[model samples]
Target chain A: MIKSNSTNSNIQQIKVAVDCIIFGFNDNKLELLLIKKKENPEKGKWSLIGGFVGFDEDLDEAANRILSDLSGLQDIYMEQIKTFGKVDRCSFDRIISSTYSAMILKSRYTEDKISKYNAQWFPITEVPDLIFDHNDMVDIAIKRMRRRVRNFPIAFNLLPPKFTLPQLQVLYEGILDEELDKRNFRRKVAQMKYLVRLDEKDMSESRRGAFLYRFDETLFENEQNFNL
Target chain B: MIKSNSTNSNIQQIKVAVDCIIFGFNDNKLELLLIKKKENPEKGKWSLIGGFVGFDEDLDEAANRILSDLSGLQDIYMEQIKTFGKVDRCSFDRIISSTYSAMILKSRYTEDKISKYNAQWFPITEVPDLIFDHNDMVDIAIKRMRRRVRNFPIAFNLLPPKFTLPQLQVLYEGILDEELDKRNFRRKVAQMKYLVRLDEKDMSESRRGAFLYRFDETLFENEQNFNL
Candidate 1:
């Protein structure tokens, strides 16, 4: 082993924090949850909902605590994508932020809870300049979500229980940031056994109405591989 | 914004460290580089090469520093896969370890440098019990490498500059942990435009020598996906 010249006492202890990029799908568009900072060091600027790591809590626990505190939701689909630890990334302190990408159904969150926390969902295309390295975090999260949605059925987390085929296609288009062919998209969706077609129809968009489908969680658990 | 009850001064700061799972390929088998701990706290046990994050450097810089310190090689393919921050993951201190997965060509490093740090390459199947959560880190790195190898030409980082088709097949098999059909694998290789065949042949393995090939980095950059 290489002889160590530094000990634990000499090494600097830095503050560790977790930031969440909560993504939602509504109005056939992808959105991100952001809060306006209330304190100094870039106050009033938009930022991802975040908090410092508690002494007794694990990193994932801290993330869950923060997410649940803001949205009043539990067991959200979340994953830690990357950790940002540049020396000057934070203006006030040399803190390391573990960034998590999460998806939650917009309808699942109560409007009162969101307003109480001063949080609002901004469409991904219209996301304004964020504080510190937050803009970079959002970009990374979106790229990860795009890659993940192709292989896994996690995109259902952002949609309601039952949704139209057009709604599903629009959600994929929003996440992929490209227009897909209608026939080819439907052909691919037709092969997925986990997406079950229901007798119900959604008449919100057109008079003819589109058939509603719900992602079967049990079947997805057994079949695996969304492969969209 | 949520009211901040925890200030930076009151929060318990923890030690942040980076551990590297350095993988290499030799004799058609995947191997890991490990060093025996020489000091107290699980001394004399095999562990991943790691060091504490310096006050002045970024996380990636710290990972590169530790990796180069042992292997005497720079610019190796490396990426941060995950951060392990369980409350009791470390026996001695409350340490938050940011684990990175790295790959290096075994032929590039001299044996003298490896022995100077008491490091040895252990086959993936033969890795001994590691201290703390190092074993779990190795498992996660392998899964990530498998997923990445299918989509990227990063597996070239483990092979020699000039290699045979059989050698490449064996390397892929080792990474994917499965035997692929020869005809199917060859057909897939034929579709990759960036694997340039050379005039040389490697005769060490068979009476009928196989032709050598090298990866075209420029073509790969333009083509983007390996899609193996």
Candidate 2:
């Protein structure tokens, strides 16, 4: 029957919430934006920028809203990692979290407008104790990010318009959680041949200035279709 | 404000449903199992076997429900295809569908059980007009099925414990929707050395039936790691 069983019935009950795991590449370190929840149940504890999804809003839109509200960055790479529907996962209610991961270059958000709600960036390696179920979300996000980084040049989205090869390698190393051999890594990237060596050099890193490189999105997209 | 702006906001106002786009490889025909909807807003129309997901139910469980309900088969090769969240997609009060796809060898379901639900196996090349956004769902499901079949040994789960060389080839052609050069395909598969050739033959398709082939999951997994 199409009749409503309602929430009070003996049947199972579910509450849905949206959690965002934002990964940023900045200062040769991989960081994730985390908000301190000043609300009840887990007050003053670090958590993913999250809220209960509205009945009328699409999950994708809700993900965007959360990203914009907290970080002021948009049009970033975002994907649904998975849905966590464990019944007893939430203590206050039966919240099933739909997790999303968005990327932003730390340089882009350096002047981020922080709201009264305390927001801070913590290196993924040095994250603080997060409130209920958020740590699980971040863990999954990292796993997904690592897999995508291997199959595609998705890390470029989380970078500045102009960056040195060393900086690019550092970002990949941070996301992949491994040391990439400089010679082999650059050789492999050169094989793709989608990056344009810019005239400028970022002189901030060391004594010898490094030549900056900017990726050609159109060319990079075409190269992606090459299946190599 | 933990409290939502609206009172009835957090409640899942619209029904959340799941649909299974079941694909069966039989002979050389790629088939889909479609049932006549018993309930409206789209009643009596040929559509995917679908039902409302119970609260606190895992997506995999709900997918299994649709499979067993339609085909009397459990532990089939099922996967979450995608979630369709277009507003007003369903004619009723805003229903969001999370679709799953199952691959099954057509030999499993008996003709009697298939006829019980007024179900018929239609060749994917000649699928009839479906109700709701089901046609779109099937299209996406087929794409996902093809992608999985190539990388993962998911096609093996659909077949029996033993299958002939022709059977494996036919499975690939049907799912991929393309013709394969037999000698080349066999050579490539042999190069992988994941499949074991059995002495036994089906002796069904011809006077001299081809030798059966079974893939070694452990071997394929090891190869997968290396290939990546």
Per-candidate TM-score against the hidden true structure: 0.82, 0.76
Native A-B interface contacts kept, per candidate = 0.35, 0.14
Cα RMSD (Å) between model 2 and the true structure?
A: 5.7
Report the CAPRI category for model 1.
acceptable
lDDT for model 2, on a 0 to 1 scale?
A: 0.72
Q: What is model 1's native contact fraction? A: 0.35
Candidate 2 local lDDT, B1-228, one digit each (tens): 143224554345545677888888787678998887776667788888777677656656877877688756667766666666565466545556678777777786677877766678899988888977889999988876665566457777767789887777777777777777888678757755678888898888899888888878888767544332
Name the regions of candidate 1 deviating beyond 4 angstroms.
Answer: A1-12, A157-167, A183-228, B1-11, B159-165, B186-228
Q: DockQ numbers for every candidate?
A: 0.28, 0.20
Cα displacement (angstroms), candidate 2, residue A123, comes to 2.6
Cα lDDT tens digits, model 2, A1-228, are 232435433334455567888887766677888888777878888888888666677767777877777656567667877666554566656556678887767776545364434778888898887877678888878876776676467777667788888878888877776888888788767755778998887888777899999888888667543221
- What's the C-alpha lDDT at position B219 in model 1? 90
Candidate 2 has a DockQ of: 0.20
> Interface RMSDs of all predictions?
7.3, 5.7
Candidate 1 per-residue C-alpha lDDT over B1-228 given as tens digits, one digit per residue, 9 for 90 to 100: 222223433344677889989987666678899988888877899999888887678888998998788656568767899998887787666778899887766766676878777688999999999999999999999978886776567888677799998988888888776888888789778866899999989999898899999999999766542210
- Which candidate tops DockQ? 1
